[model samples]
Target: MNIKLLAVGKTDNESLQKLIDEYIKRLGFYINFNLEILPDIKNAKNLSEAQQKEKEGELILKKIQSADVLILLDEKGKQYTSEEFSGYLQKKMNSGAKQLVFVIGGPYGFSDEVYKKSSGKISLSKMTFSHQMVRLFFVEQLYRGFTILRNEPYHHR
Candidate 1:
């Protein structure tokens, strides 16, 4: 199955970009992984948080295909151990999911509409991280999950 990561805005830090790129390249060896970055909304300063989320939600929805299983990287979402996450990935692959799209929303988070459209959510941590930082963290976890699935020595018990 193809795995796609859709996130709002760009990762401006060169150091962070390098790490994210490394994981993306590593992931390509295991699956058809693609990272799609949605442009940050212009004139966002004038819009209220709700307005921004609504606009961002609209853009997010447009990127999703009918058959895609969309999952949000949300704080309120389900948390899983590395092994459990590997099992979750295996389950999706076994079910023949065409595309697994995981989204990292904008600064203020997702809208009600986006929430309703998602298949599920996965939380990386209970503590919050910057939007750019989350991209790197999520990709690393994804790489770790795949390695665990392959019985590699990357993940420790």
Candidate 2:
């Protein structure tokens, strides 16, 4: 199965981008992983929080296909340990998921429509992190998850 990460805006910090790139390359060895960055909305200062989320939602939805399993990186979603997350990844592949799409929403969060469209949600941590930072964390965790599944030396109990 293909794994796609959909996030709004680019990572402006060079160091963070470098780390994110490293994980992306590592992930390629185990699975077909794609990172799609949707451009941030222009004139966002003029829009209300709800409107901004709505506009971002439209862009997010456009990238999703009918068969894709849409999962959001939401703050309130269920949390899992590294081993459990590896099991979750294995389950998706076993279930014949074509594409597993995990989205990191904009600064204001996701729209109601986006929430309704999501098949499930996952929380990386209880405390919030910047959207850009979340991309790196999520990608690295994904790589670690795959390593755990394959019995690689990358992860340890």
Candidate 3:
């Protein structure tokens, strides 16, 4: 199955982008992966939080294919251990899914409409993280998860 990571805005920090790219490349060794960036909504000083989310939601929806399994990276979603997350990845492939779409919402979070369209949600941690930082963390963890699944030296029990 193909894995697509959808996030709003761009990663401006070069160091963080490097780390994200490294993990993304490592992840490619195990599975098909794509990192998609939705341009940040312009002139956000006027738009309310709800309206911003709504606009971002529209942009997010536009990238999705009909058969994609949408998974939101929500703060309130269930958390899993590295090993468990590997299983989650394995199950998706076993189920013959075409694409697994993982989304990181905008600063204010996702719209109700986006929530309605998702199949599930996952929280990386209980603590909050910047959207930019989360990209690094999520990509690294995804690489770590795949390594764990393949018995690679990157992860330890």
Candidate 4:
């Protein structure tokens, strides 16, 4: 199954971008993985937190396909061990899914609509992280998961 990561905004730090790129390249060896960035909203000052979430939610929902399995990266979501996450990814692939998409929502988090649309949520950590930083962390873990799946040395490194 194809795996896609959709996140709001771009990663601006050169150092972070380098690391994210490395993980993305590594992940590509295992699956059809693509990291898509949605442009950040401009002049967000006028929008309330909920309104921002709603707007971002709409954008997030639009990127999804009817058959795609949607997963959200949420702080309050189910947290999994690395092995469990690997198994989860394996199950989705085994089920013959066309595509599996994971989204990292904007600052205020997801709207109710987005929550309803998702099949599941995976939390990387209980602590909060910057939206941009989460992209790197998520991509790196994805690479690690794939490595473990293949019994590669990278996972242990």
Best by TM-score: 2
lDDT of each: 0.95, 0.96, 0.93, 0.91
Worst 10 residues of 1 by lDDT: 148-157
TM-scores, one per candidate: 0.97, 0.98, 0.97, 0.97
Candidate 2 lDDT, tens digit per residue, 1-157?
9999999999999999999999999999999999999999999999999999999999999999999999999999889999999999999999999999999999988999899999999999999999989999999999999999999998974
Task: Report the alpha-carbon TM-score of model 4 versus the true structure.
Answer: 0.97
lDDT of 1 by residue, 27-73 (tens): 99999999999999999999999999999999999999999999999
> For residue 155, what is the lDDT in candidate 1?
84
lDDT rank order: 2, 1, 3, 4
- Would you list the clashing residue pairs of candidate 3? none
Q: Over 4 Å off in model 1, which ranges? A: none
Question: Which regions of candidate 2 deviate over 4 angstroms?
Answer: none
Better of 1 and 4 by lDDT: 1
Error of 1 at 6 (Å): 0.3
At residue 99, candidate 2 shows an lDDT of: 97
2 against 4, candidate with superior TM-score: 2
**Tens digits of per-residue lDDT for model 4 on 75-132?**
9889988778888888999999999999999988899999999999999999999987
User: Candidate 3 overall Cα lDDT vs. reference?
Assistant: 0.93
Q: Which stretches of candidate 3 lie over 4 Å from their true place?
A: none
